[model samples]
Target chain A: MKSILLATTTFREAVRDRVFGLVAAFGLLLVLSTVIISPLTVGARGKIVTDIGLASISLFSLLMVLFVGSGMVHKEIDRRTIMTILSKPISRLDYLLGKYLGLWATLFVMMAAMTLIFACACALTEAEWKPTYLVALGMALCEMTVVTAVVVFFSSFTTPVLTSLFTLATFIVGHAIGDLERFAMVTGSAGMERAADISRFVLPNLDLFNVRNAVVHDLPVHSEHVVWAVVYALLYSAVLLAISDLLFRRREFK
Target chain B: MMTVLELRSVSKSYRSDFLFRRMPALTDVTFDVAAGETFAYLGHNGAGKTTTIKSLLGLIRVDAGNIRVFGHAPGTMAAKRRLGYLPENPYFYDHLTAREFLHLAARLNDMNRSDAKHRADQLLALVKMDHKANVRLRNFSKGMLQRVGLAQALIGDPELLVLDEPMGGLDPVGRYEVRRILEELKSRGKTLFMSSHILADVETLADRAAILNGGTLRRLVDLHELGHQERIMDLKFTQLSEAMVGELVRRGYPVERRAEAHHVLVEEHFAMAGLIDELVRSGSRLLRAAPHRVSLEEIFLREVERDVGQTPEDLLHRTVDELVGATSVKEESTP
Candidate 1:
């Protein structure tokens, strides 16, 4: 119940933020620009539009998480607002979970708005409306859940600038973990292989959620694969949140 | 009769890595606030007043010792449920309207929707913020923000309030309103643990006050006792001879001479009857005699001054030297 209140408040605050408004406006413009830019693709105009639209939504969501989500805890601590909230009967774990869930709520709104704009652009174009588009978007949202957790995890102990850099690096490395593992298999170096193995285990495989290419290119994406990706994202996010809670628990807000 | 808050030998130090220096913010600080009492945690800046308050609220962990709120460890939810804390320079979500903020606070305390709204409304009215309830806090003045902060602190209907500089950033009227609110809370049997440099407000509101200096507990005073003027007596005399004045001065009474009146300040423990007889014998006409009690401000200053006799510059230099020495020792032992 407390988490819901906190999440509602966070969502309200985020939606009212001028920065969120600006980012959402920019995202819509970029998504709509796909229509104008699709004619220049020379071929596969519909595919290009769908691909760009999906990628634009993903990119904007990442930007939102990186810029706004990373500051969730840092802003509270900097402004000393956490003192009042935490002084209540709320536990630190509840506070952290509330903040994480709040950012996710905010992301959900941003995604819904951007997805609406993307869908409209897709409808206006010659692209076929595939139910797979929603699946791809659902996966994108799941990927953002992981990104939000990563950003919030860094936010628990660091400044927003460092949190952003760290989360962005994590996001990049997370998406490339599969490639790193594959490279490790082909490489003859033992040390490189061990490092790759560690990276694959430690980092979230964000690539598991990247079904935009399959959906865009009209390729098959199994429902079982989607379910596994959802489970993986949730479990990874839970681990990150737990670590964040531990770090936040030990932190002194001096 | 019940202790609402207690701290025993609580200590905390902030360590800076740049110099390897650990600056102790609180040391052996101990005090308690009783139920239905207004206890003022009095100190100047850097006197560990805020540190102690934060320690009580579990915002910062003490390096040593224990703090209990209502007999439960301060970090426990059971204790927090009974306590409300207003931090120094209270900040809120600027995007949230005052009503929204209060509602959120109410809900966080587990109030149902209707109850939360009703309580929020009551608090807003109590704080005289109902008119601006829909206004975002970013538009609030410091005084307004303080009032709203107090309102939220009270929204939980907490049994105890831990306020750090509650009257800070308030105008005279705002301060008076807050004082009234505190007095009302006291009338209803709410315990208050507040830290403030405003000794006048502390004097007006505190039942007991604990003074801290140099990160140590200097003294804890019962205002009821200190409020009694009988401790010190002021005697006024007319037509007092210089010889009598000299004699009184020699006898250790604080004598002050005006153009036509001589005043002798006497401690209650001294023989006032003998002094009066001496004054009559000296053919001096007695004008008036009255008792004067010390103010909280005077006592606070005296306590701080007594802790460090030298000038502030000298004290600062000594502190720096000690920190450097401590840091050097720490670095040497690190290996």
Candidate 2:
């Protein structure tokens, strides 16, 4: 109950933030930018429109998660508002989870808005209403969930500036984990190979959520892969949230 | 009466970058607030008052000790349900109006929707914030914010209200309004554990106060005792001559001769009978005698200076300088 109250409050505050307004505005502009840019494609205007629209949504969502989510906890601490909230009946874990869910809800709203605009753009461009676009968007949302968790985790203990930097680094590294493994196999150095192997397990495999190419090229993505992606995103997010809760629990607000 | 809150031998230390040199924020601090009593925790800056409050609220874990709120460990849901806290320099969600903020606090305490709304209204009225209830907190003045903060603290109808500098950042009228609200809370039998540097407010509101200095409990003052204990006695007499004054001064009384009367400052334990006898024998007419106790401010300064190894005059000077600096900064930001 307390968590719900906190989450509601967090969502309200986040939506009211000027950064959210700016992000939404920029996201819409990016979606519409595809309208102007797609006609320049020589053959596949529909493909170009859907592809850019999905990528635009993914990129803007990641930007929102990285910049806005990074400050969710740090701002509370900096402004000393966390003291009042935590002093209530709510536990630190509840507060952390509430913030995560609240930001996630905001991300959901952003995704829905951008997807609607993207679908409209596709229809205007006479693009086929493929189920693959929705799948790609769903996976994109999952990717954002993972990234938001990473942002919250870093925001729990570090400054917003450092959290933004660290979360961005994590997102890049998470996506590259598969390539890192391949690179490690090609390298002859034992230490490099061992380090790469360890990172593959430690860092999240964000590549699982990247079904954009399959969707854009009209290739079939297996339901099993989608299930695994969902499971991995949920599990990875839970671990990050647990670590955030631990750090937040031990934190002393001076 | 029940003990609403207790802190037993609580100590906390913060580690700096310097190796093996921990800064002690609180050391062996122990005190308790009885049910329905207004307990003031007094200290200067860095005197561990805030640290103790945070420890009791479980915002920070103690290095060694125990804290119980309503006989349960603090930070537990059961205890927190009965606790409402107003932090110093409170920063609320600026996007929220006063009513929404209070409702949020009420719901977090598990109040039903209708009850939360009712209580928020009641508290807003109690703090005289009903007029601004619909305004966003970002547009509020400091005093308005403090009032709304107080309203939120009272939203749950908490049995214990832990306020850290509740009157901070308020003007004189705002402070008076806050004190009146606290007085009302006291009348309703709410236990108040307040930490404040405002000695006048403490003297006016607190039943008992504990002074902390240098991370240690310096003195616990029972204001009730001041009504019975005489600290200083003022004696007035007429027809006081220079020779009589000399005699009185020689007899160890601090006598200041006025044109119409002679004023004698007597120690609390001085022999009043002997002094009167002397006055009568000297044919000086007695005017009046009165006893006075030292003010809370005086005692606070004495304790703070004693802890810092400075004279009261020096401390007062430094305090004035600091206040001036603070005022200038505030002025710079006023526009």
Q: After best superposition, candidate 1 residue B63: deviation in angstroms?
A: 1.3
Clashing pairs in 2: none
Please give, for residues A98-214, the per-residue lDDT of candidate 2 as tens digits.
889888988898888888777777777666778778999999999999999998899899899999998888888989988887887788778878888887788878888999999
Q: DockQ score for model 2, please?
A: 0.77
Candidate 1 lDDT, tens digit per residue, A173-220? 988988887887788678878988888888888899999888887799
What's the distance in Å from true for residue B292, model 1?
A: 3.6
Candidate 1 stretches greater than 4 Å from native:
A22-24, A31-36, B227-290, B310-335
**lDDT for each candidate structure:** 0.83, 0.82
- What is model 1's interface RMSD? 0.8
Query: How many clashes show up in model 2?
Result: 0
Docking class of 2: medium
